[model samples]
Target: MWIFGWKGPSGFSASSTAEEVTQGIDGSALTAIVTGASSGIGVETTRVLALRGVHVVMAVRNADAGQNVKESILKEIPSAKIDVMDLDLSSMASVRKFASQYQSSNLPLNLLINNAGVMASPFMLSQDKIELQFATNHLGHFLLTDLLLETMKRTARESDIEGRIVNVSSEGHRIAYSEGIRFDKINDESGYYTWYAYGQSKLANILHAKELARRLKEEGVEITANSLHPGAIISTNLMRHHGLINTVGQMLGKYFLKNIPQGAATTCYVALNPQVKGVSGEYFLDSNIGNPSAKAKDADLAKKLWDFSCTLTNPK
Candidate 1:
């Protein structure tokens, strides 16, 4: 847990908690949508953001779970404006429905935190016939961001404030397959390996941000897009698929793995920190800029991903 003492240029480190990173920051007028807000780091991220006065919309696959989280937060901060919306990232139909509902509410979107993800799950296909990890982690977010982009742009333009999009990637991105994306073989069951698939999805998260940032910059939009590694928080259900890993983690995790607060720190920092103003298309770790694998930095791959995602998420 001492990933804390080692500070970065941001004067924060892996040990910093979400509340600590966002202290003194007032987000009273901002509105944010955080996916997977019912559990793990997503819960902490939502809580801290609400604490900072941001109107938070919890987009979770489970409405009951999301309501529970919302209630718990409200119990602590009665003034916090929070809403729960059902969203199943693995289903493109659900994403569109959620986006439509959100837009219809006419809520201003200042921050988008793509924090929900599945890790190292056994091979499975989403309702759309896409690989589950890639579908939920990368493609879901891509479409959600695309759908809400107009609102974010309008908010920035009308309010004269910067908009931010944060993608929660992982260090596991460096562990992907030789092709990085496995684009041509995305659903090839015979070739699928759990870790590689998860890595590929995480890598996609970074590339999505890179390509999105580039496009936003070209358009001269005030919105910035970036990705981050939220550290390994062993208590989360992210590793639920691996019985052996969970066993080992229970024994040795508390000694080294990040606690929930630490895991959510970088997210809160990247989302609300004034120090991050104008930065985009970068990878962050421990609340500071960190290097990603060369493959994760490939601009052509990013552009290709953008086009590919467009086809997959296209309504027609």
Candidate 2:
């Protein structure tokens, strides 16, 4: 159970709601693409970003569900510039197609919120024949970012506004395999554990941001890439695969877990807050710069993971 803890340096704590953390931030000129925008914290994050006057593009797997969410948000904020685009983060072809479609629209992208992810499910393979959790959570976003990075860079150069890429990682990153990532054994189901695979995917999220931040910094681009733990977000459909755990969580969630709004606060803060303007490559918790596992900070591991992802997604 999480009590209202001490506020971080950002004057926000685990109890802070998304709207509370982003008060008075006018993002009228900014445009954002939030993956998984139809469900869970993704919905709240999309709602809050739209409330701040940002033109939000909801990148979701289900166009129907996405439109439902968009309509719901419009009831609250009729002026919101929101669009729903179909995006299945579990499929690389779907990612590429969505990116190409987005590029054809000639819309500027000031933010890319890679918020889509799957949790611990039984061992399965993606359409790409890679481990399901790693493929959807890490590789899909990896390819999507690679495809849209040029657009983000151009938008920053033309608009003179810094772009932000927020990767919604989790505290489960600490529970990955002893090696953090299993590069050689990624598809070896014989040795796989569901939760550990999920942790590996989350850890990969942080490392992706780290290495990406480094590259963008080297190029002198006005874009920041950072990752964060959105707190213990157990109330969502993400727990559907965890039978007993899901049951226990629902029964005790009100007392123990952060509510959906509170769970989304960190993502909103990292994406739109002026305080995070120049910050890059850092892991955040409770809307403040927080330390990640040492493995997450291992620059070598970050580079290696970046290379591995490139090989899988780019394939040059």
Candidate 3:
């Protein structure tokens, strides 16, 4: 029963825009990796960070789409330092390749935003024969983070600055997978429920952050791992495959929820804001450390997920 006391700092809000969240933050010395950067909140989040002179690596599956996103950012901020990298989160091989390339660069990563995801799509599997949502949303990021943990730790020690990893989760995680992470059923090729699987994956994101934080703490590392819900952003085409769901989500967005910039507030806040410089393993929403469900704080499940991820990634 981990109690989450929503002690919001000054200048934070549910409606805070990405620019507002990172106002006055100097990121010229930082390097960040943002997944799902091809479009939507992922793109907007990277744009905000890049505007601050942060060298942002746009990790996406499609090179052409990534180039388009890079152009859009360059158009907005001509001085934005944006690099496009091939990262198909659905494939373990692609994830490994990206990790290898990143590690070989020897550049310290200041931030990592696991923002790529699919929602409410038809059931599918990755090339690794894992559930699509679980593989891409949670497992892929899990492996990538594990692969780069050493680099982040080294960077923190060398620069004496906090290295951050932000797992972009959703409020939807609260609705499903409440019964605990089903490690046994994770690879049910036949039991394909988009919403349920998506929920489980999102929960895994939160769990991953919690577990990573615990491990880093034990290892005396300065890299912080935190999870955040980006709120309901209409700009992200997560529901494009589900026509009715997309329509309803859009309508709800028009009526309530944050705009694209606002939706990305908590994510940007967790990634670079000074208020949470050392805060890790916490679940945030609306730019504040909000209360997660009882299940979200299950340390045991977090450890279980971490172990499962280790087996999946086979990190030595």
Would you list the clashing residue pairs of candidate 2?
A: none
Inter-residue clash pairs, candidate 3: none
What tens digits encode model 1's per-residue C-alpha lDDT throughout 1-316?
A: 3554888899998788899999999999899999999999999999999999999999999999999999999999999999999999999999999999999999999999999999999999999999999999999999999999999999999999899999999999999999999878998998899999999999999999999999999999999999999987547878889888888887787888788888899999999999999999999999999999999999999999999899889957
Candidate that beats the other on TM-score, 2 or 3, i.e. the better one: 2
Shift of residue 29 alpha carbon in model 2, Å: 0.6
Q: Rank the candidates by lDDT, best first.
A: 1, 2, 3
Instruction: Give the worst 10-residue stretch by lDDT in candidate 1.
Output: 1-10
| Model 3 regions more than 4 Å off | 1-8, 189-191
Clashing residue pairs, candidate 1? 4-15
Q: Once superposed on the true structure, which residue ranges of model 2 sit more than 4 Å away at CA?
A: 1-4
Provide the TM-score for each candidate, comma-separated: 0.98, 0.98, 0.94
Q: Write the per-residue lDDT of candidate 2 for residues 1-316, one digit (tens) a residue.
A: 2384788888888888999999999999999999999999999999999999999999998999999999999999999999999998888899999999999999999999999989998999998899999999999999999999999999999999999999999999999999999999999989999999999999999999999999999999999999999988558889889778888887898887888999999999999999998999999998999999999999999999999999998666
Better of 1 and 3 by TM-score: 1
Q: Report lDDT (CA) for all predictions.
A: 0.94, 0.94, 0.85
Query: What is the Å distance of residue 45 in model 3 from its true position?
Result: 0.7
* Candidate 3 residue 76 C-alpha distance from true site, Å: 1.8
